[model samples]
Target: MVELKSPAEVEAMARAGAVVAEALTAVAGLAEPGRTTADLDRVAADVLAAHGATSPFLNYHPRWASSPFPAVLCVSVNDAVVHGIPTDEVLADGDLVSVDFGAVLDGWCGDAARSFIVGTPRPADADLIAATDRALFAGITAVKPGNTLGDIGFAIAASVRRDGYGLLADHGGHGIGRTMHEAPHVPNEGRRGKGMKLRPGLVIAIEPMLIGDGTEDYVHDPDGWTLRTASGARAAHSEHTVAVTDDGARLLTL
Candidate 1:
């Protein structure tokens, strides 16, 4: 069933999103050379704890996973596109890190992700990150009542492909409100005018994962998580939870 949030519910979700934003900020600050992925997860955990928010990622037993997720945050590194489990692996200078997180506050949910370069700079990785973020916002710009899901997907895909980047064929966004994931999974690519019509009060996560060098091939790690690029290229991810409204998209996870 499609759950439409009233304006008041939307406001409440924004509160949850604010906590996510704070946690991401804290993670970014602590993500640097000599720090382990576990370090990043620890900071995010502290932020969620301080806010009295619960993590949707921690102990999450999605259908495809062999076991429950073990951490509060997903610390995907370099070629690993998404679902990279946080571990004791130390980060090095110029390594790309993507942190995906979700938080629930006051019975509402918010989810988001951000990719960044740690310590030293890598021009190509930075460019991919910028492009991935642009693709996410492009999808967000298309989130309005009367628009089709295909339109939003096309907007994101066009932006990514324009820069010679590709998206993960399987992973995409989803409806998010009282729960972290819900009906109507949104894709990164689709034909315009197809799919269900978007409506007001419908909130969804708009996330774009850019496969560097425009390849869709990825290797699934033995850990039953972590998707790495087959060619060993880097990847970038960006996301924001948004609410459809009479005006336009109201970003919850800003």
Candidate 2:
């Protein structure tokens, strides 16, 4: 069932979102060439711990998975779309790194992700990251009382498609609160005035994943967690946790 949060409940989720934002900020700064995904994972774990929060991804075993998640973050390198696992693989120059993370604080959850260039980036790669980032914010802007989920999705799709990138098909954002993933599957592309109407106390994660130059199709890696582009093109993802309020959309995962 789709659940709308109370104002006080929204405040709790905001606190969790703050921890998620800080964790992402710290990990992003440390994500340079030569750092392994595991290294960044540790950074996020420590940051969440300091805030008295724990990783929602750790030991999380959603249906369709055989084992619990063993890492604090999803680290997808170039050509990888989402759900990338942390490994011994070291980041190299000019690589595109996508970090997806979540935190549980006082029983609420916050989830967000971003992709960035490691070193001196290629013009195309840099452009993709920029577009994806803008798309995420554009989607968030559409989250407000009375708006439909389609408004958010259409905004993101229009922003990225204008630049010629393809949206990932299989995965999208979701409602997040006491649980990691909840009702309201927020897609990256949809028609405005469609889907569920937004109301005060509704919190959702708005993310957009764009492929550099390929179809929307994606395939999971052999590890059972990592998702990569089917055509081997680079991908970028960006997200933020937002709450619909009587005033407007407030970003919790800033």
Candidate 3:
């Protein structure tokens, strides 16, 4: 069943969202060329600690995974899409890095992701990132009372398709609250005016994963987590946790 959060619960989630935003901001600054992905993960852990928040991603074992997740951050570099485990691999000058993170505070959860260029950006990398960012906002704009979940997905997919980008169809957003994932899976593409109707107090994480070469096929890394483009094309991801309110969509992770 889809659970609706109370106003007080929403406030608690906002606090968690603030921690998520702060950690992402701090880690983004440290994503330099010579730093290992593990280094960025450490920064994320420290930021969460400073805010008295706990990482929701740490040691998280989903039904599809073989082992517990090892890091607080999903550092996907270049062609990787999402769930890229942090490792000792050093970042290069022109690599596109996508960082996905989540946090829990006062029993509520917040999740978000961002993609950025390390040093010198390669051709079309900035465009790819911008497209995903735009798609995320498009999804957010579609969240309102009486609007269906399909409306949110259609808006996101329309924005991505306009830029000629390919979305990771199998993976999409999800309802979030006390748990990291919940009911009412939010896909990135769907028919408008269909699916579950949006209502006040409903909260979800809307994320867009776009590929530069317009391909949806991806391969999982041997580590049983990381997902990379099957054609070796670069990808970008952007996400934000939002709440459907009486007025409109309130972005908790802003």
Candidate 4:
């Protein structure tokens, strides 16, 4: 069942979201040519620790996974779409880096992801990341009272598909509360004006994963989690946790 949050709960969630946003901003500043993905993960963990917040992704074992996740953050580089595990891999010029991080404060959770270019510009890489960022905002605009889940999905899909990017089918956004993932799974593609109706006090993470030059298929690496594009084309992901209020949508994860 979908649980509507109280004003107090939303306030606490906003606190959690602030930590997540600050963490992402810190990590983004640390991303540059020659930095290892693991180094970026360390930066995020240290920031969260300084804020007295805990990472929700650490050792998290979802039902589909064979084992618990072992990283504080997801560092997907280039062809990897989402759930990319941090490793000793070093960043190179023109590589597209996608960082997915989540933080929990006082049992409340906030999740977000961002894609960035390491050094010099690759036209395709820049364009792909920009498109995913736009798609994320398009999905966020649909989060309001009375709008169906499909409305959110359709807005996301329409934007990315128009740019000729592939919408990821295996992974999508979900309802987030005390836990990382919850009910009302939000897909990247759907028919508008359909599915569950949005209501006040509902919080959901709307993420868009767009593949620049591939199909919908993804391959899991040996690390047991990182998913990469099947066609080796670059991928980008952007996300934000948002809450529907009496007025409109308020971004919890800024």
Candidate 5:
């Protein structure tokens, strides 16, 4: 069932979202050539600690996962689509890094992700990132009372496809609150006005993952977590936690 958060619960979630933003900011600041992905993970871990927040990602074992997740942050790079585990692999000057993290504060959960280049970015990579971010905004824009879930999906898919980018299928955002994942799974592409109607108190994560070469095909990394482009194309992802309110959409992770 889709569980809605009370106004006070939503406010508490914003506090968790703040911690998530801080961790993402610190991770972005520390991401550079010569630093390992693990290094960025440490910075995020520290940020969560400083805020007295816990990671919902740590030790999380989903039905599809081979084992419990061992890291607080998922740092995907270049062709990796999502859930890239942090390792000692050194980042290169032109690597496109995407970090996905979540924080739980006082039992509320906030999740977000962003893709960026380590140093100077290739024109194509920058475009991919921009398209992904724009798609995320489009998705967030659809989060309002009376809008359907399909509207959110259509908005995001249209935004990315207009820029000649493709998105991974089946992997999208979800309802979030006391738990990181909740009901009312939100897709990145859908027929407008075909799904659940958006209502006040509905809180969710809006994320868009765009494929650089304009194809939905992707290959799963043997790690059972990381997913990569099947055509060896690069990808970018962007996300934010948002709440559907009486007035409009309220971004908790801003």
Candidate 6:
């Protein structure tokens, strides 16, 4: 069921979102060649600890997973799309990295992700990251009272298509509140005006994942968590938690 958050609950969620944003910023700053993905996870854990927030990703076991998540950060590199576990793998120059994180503070949750290039960036990789970032904002802009969930997905899909990128249809956004993942699944591609109607107090995470090779097929890693593009094409992801309000969309994870 879709639960509309009260004003007080929304305020709590905003606090959690702030922690998530700060941790992601700090982690992103450390993304460089020669740094290990596990190193990034350590930084994220410190940030959350300093803020008195708990990691929502750590030890999280969804039905599909064989075991609980082992790290605070989802560190996807190169062809990896999402759910990438932190490993000792060293980041290399021109590698495209995507980090997804979630934090819980005062019983509320916030989730977000960002993709960028480490060290010397290739032109195509930079463009791929830029496109996903733009798509995230486009979807966030579509969040407002009376707008359908399809509207959000349509806006995001249009942005990706305009850049000639492929959308990861299997993985998309979701409603977020007391829990990390909630009701009303938000796909990256859909027909406008075809899904649930948006309303005030409805908070959601709008994320867009795009592939460089224009393919949606992906494969799972031996870890039973990491997802990578089957065609070995690089991918990028961007996300932000937003709330639909009477005025407009309020970005909780800004």
- Candidate 2 C-alpha lDDT tens digits along 1-254: 88999989999999999999999999999989899999999999999889889888999998998788899999999999898899899999999999999999999999999888898899999999999998898898888888899998889889988988999996789998989889889988989999999999888988899999947889988888888999999999998888999998998989
lDDT assessment of candidate 3 = 0.94
Q: Give the better candidate number (1 or 2) by lDDT.
A: 1
Cα lDDT of model 6 by residue, 44-80, tens digit: 9999999889998999999999999999999999999
lDDT of each: 0.92, 0.91, 0.94, 0.90, 0.93, 0.93
Q: What are the TM-scores, per candidate, against the unseen true structure?
A: 0.98, 0.97, 0.99, 0.98, 0.99, 0.98
Stretch of 10 with least lDDT, candidate 6: 167-176
Q: List residue ranges in candidate 3 displaced over 4 A.
A: none
Candidate 5, lDDT over the whole model: 0.93
Winning model by lDDT: 3
**RMSD versus native structure for model 6:** 0.8
Q: Which ten residues in a row have the lowest lDDT in candidate 4?
A: 163-172
TM-score of 6: 0.98
- lDDT per residue for candidate 5 within 1-254, as digits (tens), equals 99988999999999999999989999999998999999999999999889889999999999989988899999999999899999999999999999999999998999999999999999999999988999999888887888899999999999988999889978899999989999889999988997999999999999999999999988888899999999899999898999999998999987
